[model samples]
Target: MHWFLAVERRLTRTALELAIIAMALVVALTFYQVVTRFVLGHPSAWSEVAARSAMIWMVFLGLAAAFRMGSMIAVDLLVDLSPPAMRRIVHMIVGVASLVFLAILIWYGTAMALRVRSQNLAGMSITIAWVYAALPAGSALALFGVIARMMEVWREPAGAHDDELKNVEGSV
Candidate 1:
C-alpha cells in the first residue's frame, strides 16, 4: 500500500505538471490566434486547432490530479451520513463505481482513438488520434489516483474521516 500510494502520488504530480504546461500552451496559442486574427487582420487556422487540442490535453491531464485530491464530482453526503462502520462500505462502493467508469472510458477511448488514427485535425497535419488518445491515457492515470485515495480512506481510523466540507475543499 505504501509503495502504491507513492507511485500514485508521483503519477498525479507529474500529470499536474504536464497539465499546467498544456494549459500554458493553450493560452499562448489562443493569444497568438487572436493577435494574428484581429491585430494583423489575418486569421491563423492552424493556431485555432492547436489551441483547441492543447485545451483538451490540459483538461485530461488535470483529471488525475483532481481524482487524487478527491476533488472530482462526488456525493459525500451518503458516506458522511452513514455510521462509522458503514462509511467504509460506502467508500468501497464509490471506489468500485469510479474504477468501473474509468475502465469503460479507457476501453472506449482507446477504440475511438484508433478509429481516428488515419484522420487529420481540422487545420493541422497532425493525426486526430493524438487528440483522442487523451481520453484513455488520462483515464488510466485517474484510475490509479482513485485507487490511491480509496486506500487512504480505508486506512483511516473509525470516525477519523473528514466531513463533506473538507472533501469539497480537497482536504481528503
Candidate 2:
C-alpha cells in the first residue's frame, strides 16, 4: 500500500509539473500574439490555434491534478454532517461510480480519436486526431486517480478512525 501511494504521488507531481508547463506556454504564446498584433501589425497565423490547444491541455491536465489532490468540486456538506460509517459508505459508492464513468469516457474518447485520425485541421497541417486525444488522456489519468483513492478508502477496516476527520471535528 505504501508503494502504491508513493507511485500515485509521483504521478500526481508529474502531472502538476506538466500542467504548469502548459500554462507557461499558453501565457507566453498569448504575449507573443499580442506583441505581433500591436508592434508588428502582423498577427501570427498559428497563434490562435496554438493558444486554443494549450488551453485545452492545461484545463484537462489541471483538472486531473486537482482531482488527485482531493480539490475537485464536490458537495460534501451533507457528508460532513453524517456519521463516519455513513461517510465511508458514501465515499465507496462515489468512487465506484466515478471509476465506471471514466471507463466509459475512455472507451468513447478513444473511438472518436480513431475516427478522426485520418482527418486534417482546417488552418493548420496538424492531424485532427492529436487535438482530440486530450479526452481519453485526461480520462485515463482521472480514472487512475479515482481508483487509487477508492483503494485507500476500501482498505480501511470498518470503524477505522480517521485522524483528519477527528481533527476537523475537534474530537482529538
Candidate 3:
C-alpha cells in the first residue's frame, strides 16, 4: 500500500508539473505573438490559431492535474453535513461515476480526433486531428486520475490523512 501510494503521488506530481509547463508555454507564446504583432509590425499567420490551440490543451491538462490533486470543484454542502463514513461512500460513488464518464469521453474524443485526422483547420493549415487530440489525451489523463483517486478512497484507512481538496479548481 505504501509503495502504491508513493507511485500515485509521483504520478500526480508529474502531471502537476507538466500542467505548469504547458501553462507557461501558452503565456510565453501569447506574449511573443503580441510583441511581434505590434512591436515588429509583422503578425504571424499561425500564432492566433496556435495560441488558441495551446490554451485548449492547457485547460485540459489543468483539468487532469486538478483531478489528480483532488481539487476538482464540488458542491459539498450536503456531504459536509453527512456522517464521515457515509461521506466516504458518497465520495467513492462519485469518483467511480466520474471514471465512467471519463471513459466515454476518451472513447468519443479519440474517434472524433481520428475522424478529423485528414481535415485541416480553416485558418491555420494544421491538421484538425491535432486540435481534437487534446480531448482524448486529456480525458485519458483524467480517467487515470479518477481511478487513482477511487483506489485511494477504497483502500484508505480510518483517520487517514487525506489532502485531496487542494487540487480542485476550474477544470475542463
Candidate 4:
C-alpha cells in the first residue's frame, strides 16, 4: 500500500503539473489568436485549434488531482451524517463507481483515438489522436489516485474522521 501510495502521489503531482502547463499553453495560444485576429486583422486557425487541444488536455490531466483531493462529485451532507461504518461503505461505493467510470473512459477513449488516428487537426499536421490520448492517459492516472484515496480512508481510525469532518465543515 505504501509503495502504491508513493507512486500515486508522484503520478498525481505530475498530472497536476502537466495540467497547469497545458492550461498556460491554452491561455497563451488563445491570447495570441485574439491578438492576431482582432488587432492584426489576420486570424490564426492553427492557434485556435491548438488552444482548444490544450484546453482538452488541461481538463483531463487535472482529473487525477481532483479525485485524489476528494473534490470530485460527492454528497457530502449524506456522508457527514452517516455513522463511521456507513461512511466507509459510502466511500467504497463512490470509489468503485469512480473506478468504473474511469475504466469506461479508458476503453472508449482509446477506441475513439484509434478511430481518429488517421485524421489530422483542422489547421495542424499532427493527428487528432494526440488530442484524444489525454482521455485514457488522465483516467489511468486518476485510477491510481482513487485507489490511493480509498486506501488512505480505510487505514484511518474509525473516529479519526470526526475531527476532519468538523474541519471541513468549518472551511465550507
Q: Identify the candidate with maximal lDDT.
A: 4
lDDT of 4: 0.85
- Residue lDDT tens for model 4, 1-23: 77987888888899999999999
> Can you write out model 3's per-residue Cα lDDT over 1-172, one digit (the tens) per residue?
5676566566656666667777787888888889889999998777777777877777776667666656644625545666776767777777877788878877888999999989987677789888788887877777767777667666766425244433323222
Candidate 2 per-residue lDDT over residues 5-73, each given as its tens digit: 677666666666777888899999999989999999998888777877887777767656665544434
The alpha-carbon deviation from the true structure for residue 60 of candidate 4, after best TM-score superposition, in angstroms, is 0.7
Residue-level error in angstroms, candidate 1, position 165: 12
TM-score for all models, in order of appearance? 0.89, 0.82, 0.80, 0.91
Candidate 2 Cα errors over 4 Å, as ranges: 157-172
Instruction: Report lDDT (CA) for all predictions.
Output: 0.83, 0.70, 0.70, 0.85
Q: Candidate 3: misplaced stretches above 4 Å?
A: 1-7, 75-78, 158-172
By how many angstroms RMSD does model 2 differ from the true structure?
4.4
Candidate 1 lDDT by residue in tens digits, 1-172: 8798788878888988899999999999999999999999999989999989889989989999887766644546776578878877787788899899999989999999999999999988999999999999999999998898777777777566555325633422
Best by TM-score: 4
- From the highest lDDT down, the ranking of the candidates is 4, 1, 3, 2
